[model samples]
Target: MKILHTSDWHLGATFEGIGREEDHKFFLNWLIPFLKEQEIVVLIIAGDLFDQTQPSAEAQRIYYQFLLSVSQKTDVKKVIIVGGNHDSPTRLDAPAELLKLLDVFIVGGISVDGKDFSRYLCSLKNEQNAVELVVAAVPFIHEYRLGVRTSMHNESEIHSLFKEKIQNFYFDLADAAEQIAQDAPIIATGHMACRGSELDDAPQEIHMIGTMGGLPSAIFDSRYSYIALGHIHRAYRVDQSNAYYSGSPIPLSIKESNYPRYVQLISYEKGSKAKTVQKIEVPVLRKILEVKSNLEQIHSILLNISWQTPMPPILAISVQVNSYHSGLDLELKNILKNKFQDASPIIAYIRQIPAKSDNNVLASKEAFSLKELTPEQVFLKMCDTYNEIVDENLLQAFRSLLNEENI
Candidate 1:
């Protein structure tokens, strides 16, 4: 049997501020043909089907369209989708009955009863109606969903309790799967952060039902033939040979620009213990180029860009400047305009890099002083630092609050 493993589609995500609808459409269009060519029997999407919990209308359209295509257009028999932390369980589960008729399985989260481990266990059959694969479709296990009541006040105790609950959850589901299809190859799907996995971007705040830190890779029981994981954007293997993260199909952040995006294909026979895994690379629909250099270097790079394709790649330019130049941004914009007159590249962002300064110099009396500024000035300075825009009305509101505080 051949199964395709992919995750973190993050549909409706935006690159910086630019919408990724085109990029996602390209990938989905490409995926249908590939699945047919590979003659895949099952497609597994680990988690994070949509970027946001409440996806936009356009996002819903794209998601449904893809599902329709896969079910009707492709030769693939079955698809399994799990929910991530960003997914709303109720929303993903709303279409459960309808999608089931099309041979698509979705595990949005734990059932309302919370302790029903049987809900996560699913058995897949081939055209002969013989069960060939057993999957424990465990969605993102939040602590609250596990029905564990903890009175422990200590941080360590809370962490330990959460870990135990999660481990037990998986074990229960695996046991259930084993009971139903003991002879078939068992596969488990999960959406959670696992320890020792590499992250493509700088760590962002992740507050979920489980512990703030990731769970150990050893948590996955060795009973399953393969474990498909999601949550982390970068593709990598966990401690065991059978455990792997297929990663996001598209780059979600600038930090992930260089990471290769691919999906995994697994083939296993009825009685064989050994499974063959293949990494199928997804073609880059569009390029996200990040350039950090001096003014001259930036100008050269932009002018030298080969614009052979119809659409130019998005550019994120960061220029190192010793001091502020009045028309520097305008100058750079003009340069790009002159070079790509026919087809202008999308400018994602432009960052100004201030030169390094000595700490002692900054502490000196002559250096820039925040204490000498007024409350409004300080607020405006903060806005500049965070690259936020404050309208006149908002600025007035801040001033009024400051006045009330006598600052």
Candidate 2:
């Protein structure tokens, strides 16, 4: 049996307000054929199926359409999807009964009691209807769900408690699987931040995940053949453990533009473990490029850049200025229009970054264009620009506001 592992599709995601509908379409178009060719029997999308909880209608359509197409067109026998931190359990679980008709197992979240272990256990059978492989279809787990917290404890102490709770949860699940399995090999899935995985580079995102953290990989039982993971945007193994993150099929940000995005193909047999693995690269259907330099350098690089995608690439241009010019933005836009008259890259962002010494001198520079950083990071930077000290209570309030919906 050949099982393909992938995660963090982030469907309906946009690059600086420019919709990525075409790129996502192209990826699905590419994926369908690959699955057929590889003759994969099980498909595992570990987490983050959509970029947001409430995805656009178009995104939802694409998702359902792809699922329908794959079921009808491919030789794949099963599809497994779990929830990520960005996913809404209710939204995904709503379609559970309907999707089962197409042989898709969607575990959006743990049960209310967190003891419904049976729902997560998926038994993969062979030609004779004999059980071959068992999967622990775990989803993204939050600290609150674990019910481990202490107001009097230090931060480190609290983390240890959470870690113990999480580890115990896995242990209970594994024990249940072991009792049920006579000979079938068991693998598992998870969507959380682990200690040694490469992370997405946005500062605020980093901070947020850091607080939730880097769960120690040692917590997982070594009994499982393979533990497919998600949440981390980078595809890598956690310090040479049985677990591995398949990462996103497409780069989510400019910082991720250079990542070698691919889904893993793992070889499995009727009675053995998931043996070997192979990476089948997913082509970047479009580009998201960022260039930061003096105007002359920026202009030169943009014109000479290589673009081998079907769609016009999304671009972020940062022009370093010694002195501010009111019309620089207009001038740059005009220049781009003239230069790439035939097919121009989409100018998603254009910001003039003055020298650090010049930050406080001009209001424009003080209110800098935000890119890549989290809202909190940008807010702190703004405070730094005005030389203001924020009290702890004020910072906490700001964080609360940041986490609020529709803000």
Candidate 3:
């Protein structure tokens, strides 16, 4: 069976506050051709179908349009999509019966017993082979939904409780997979960071743990043919070849600038134990670029890289300017948006100030003066000013990280 594993679509997502509708459309255009070339029978999108729980009307329109376009372009027999934290499980799965008519299975949210949606079965055909595959859809399950009741008295106990809860989830998932498969080659799809996989620094971590269960090492063993995971933005392998994450097609944020964005193509033979996986980078509407430059240097770089008509919304442009250059925020934002026809550019500017000398002006010249404060110190100071309870524990952790980085 030839399948495509991809996740974290985050439809309606904005790059630096600029909508990603055009970029997503471009993805569908490339995706259809790729599927045709590979003759992919199954398309598995693990999760994060949308960037918000309640997507805007425009978001809904684009999402439905993309699905319709996919159905039109490829001979793909089945499309399985789960829900990530950013998605509204109910909304994504609202028209399940309607979508099933179009051969799309959307598993938005799971119930208390780890059963929110039905198992999907699809027949995949290659040149001289045909096989049936069963997919156990496990959407993003939060700790509360696990129905885990824990009353731990200490840190160690809390960790143990968490571990036990995770084990139960995996057990439930395994049981569900077995019941759902009913002898067909089993494939699992969900939105969770397995162990040995780096969690993309997304805002989701601020609220809930992606999933209770870490990577299941033994999942690479018998019965389960493949595990398609989401949550992490960068698609990668975790335990082994059987488990994979097809990363986000577009750069979700500036921090994701370094990762090469791509999707995956998986070719599996039912009778055989091995599978083939390929990564495909979709053509993007606008290229995301990042550069760190000082104030004196950025004007030239901006002019050199500036767009004439259509341009990618700039994000978090790091700049180094003289400390004396006060209040350039409004001017900088105007220059960027006005020229590029974007909303606003994300900024990360730093000022370069010389060390204070002995003769430097002081409120009281009774004590010795200190040299220039580093960027790390500047950040901590700002944090302190903004946050009322900048306590010692968080401060110590931040300091340790700064010291480790030699910042």
Candidate 4:
């Protein structure tokens, strides 16, 4: 039986203010054909199906459209989707009954009744009606939903409770899968961050709830044949190849550009203890480039950009300067427009980096005591740090509110 493992689709995500509908559509289009070509029987999307908890209507449309296409276009018999911290359990679970007809199992979250472990355990069978694989589809467990009562006052106690609850949850599911089909390979799915996983210095949000530390990889026992994980956006193995993160199908941040996006195909022969894994790289639908240089260097690079490509790359430019220069911004924008006239480059952001001397001037100020400043002064200083202008009317309103509160 062949199963394709992928995660962190993060559909409906936008790069800066620009929508990624087309990028995601391209990925889905490419994936459907690959699934058919590979004759993959089961597809497992570990988590984070949507970029946000409440996805846009278009995002929902894309998701359902892909699922419908899979059923109609591919030989895939079973699909397992688990929810991540970014997903709304209710939203993902809404089409549970309908999707079940398509042999797509969605585990949005843990059941309200904690005792019902059957929901998380599923069995996939071959054409002959024999169980070929057993899956423990565990979704993102909100720490509070784990039903562990612990003193929130003590940090160590809270971590202990969370660790215990999470370990027990998987333990129950694995136990159930074993009971159902001991011979069948038990593949487990998780949407939480695991310890020892490498994280990129990207702007992507890491969903850390309650505690900062991740669950130890040791939590996944040897009983399971393979453990598929999500949350961390980089594809890597945890402890061994048997446990791995498929990562996101597309890059979510600039730091992620260095890592190649791909999905893993796992094949297991009937009655065989070993499984073969293959990495299938996903094609880059669009380019995300981060350029860092001085103002002159940036100008030269932008002017020399080739227009041979169908579309210009989405760029994040960081130009070092002695101070903020409106001329430099205008020049870069005009150059980019002239270079790629038909398809204008999407500038994700233009960060202005003050020169060392300028930084030294700013750093020369002695650290002011917060207690010495008035509320209005503190607010103004905070706004200055971000180069934001504080409106006089808004400042007055704040002062009035402060006076009324007798502070």
RMSDs, each prediction? 8.5, 3.3, 8.2, 8.1
**In candidate 2, residue 277 scores what lDDT?**
75
Task: Report residue 359 deviation for candidate 2 (angstroms).
Answer: 9.7
In order, the Cα lDDT scores of the candidates are: 0.75, 0.78, 0.63, 0.77
In the range 283-335, model 1's lDDT, one tens digit per residue, is 75667788788888988998887643236777877776667667777788788
- Ten consecutive residues with minimal summed lDDT in candidate 4? 201-210
Query: How big is the positional error of residue 95 in model 2, measured in Å on the Cα after superposition?
Result: 1.0
Tens-digit lDDT track for model 4 on 1-407? 78999998988888777788887888898999999999999899998999888999999999998999999999998899999877888899999989998889999987888769788888987678888888889887766577543323244665677677777777777788898876888999997777665434222323322234666776786788888887878777776646888888887766666667889889988677589887788886776788888888998888876533235678888777766787766788888888778677788777776555643674334334453355666888888999988874565455444433421
lDDT for predicted candidate 3 compared with the true structure:
0.63
Residue 288 displacement in candidate 1 (angstroms): 2.1
Q: Distance from true position, residue 334, model 4, in Å?
A: 1.7
Question: Per-residue lDDT of 27-91 in model 2, one digit per residue for the tens?
Answer: 89999999999898889999889988899999999999999998999988889999987788889
Q: Tens-digit lDDT track for model 3 on 1-407?
A: 68888888888887545677877777777888888778888888888888888888887887787678678888788888888877888887789889987788877877644543344333333366544666766677654465432221232443355456655555565665566555557777767666665444444441122223354545343466777888878777876656788878877766565666788887767566567778776656555566556665666665556433143534455554334466655656666666656443434332333234555453122221122234444666578668746665554455444423321
Q: Could you arrange the candidates by lDDT from highest to lowest?
A: 2, 4, 1, 3
Q: Report the number of the highest-lDDT candidate.
A: 2
Using all chains and alpha carbons, the TM-scores for the candidates as numbered come to 0.82, 0.89, 0.74, 0.84
Score residue 89 of candidate 3 by CA lDDT.
80
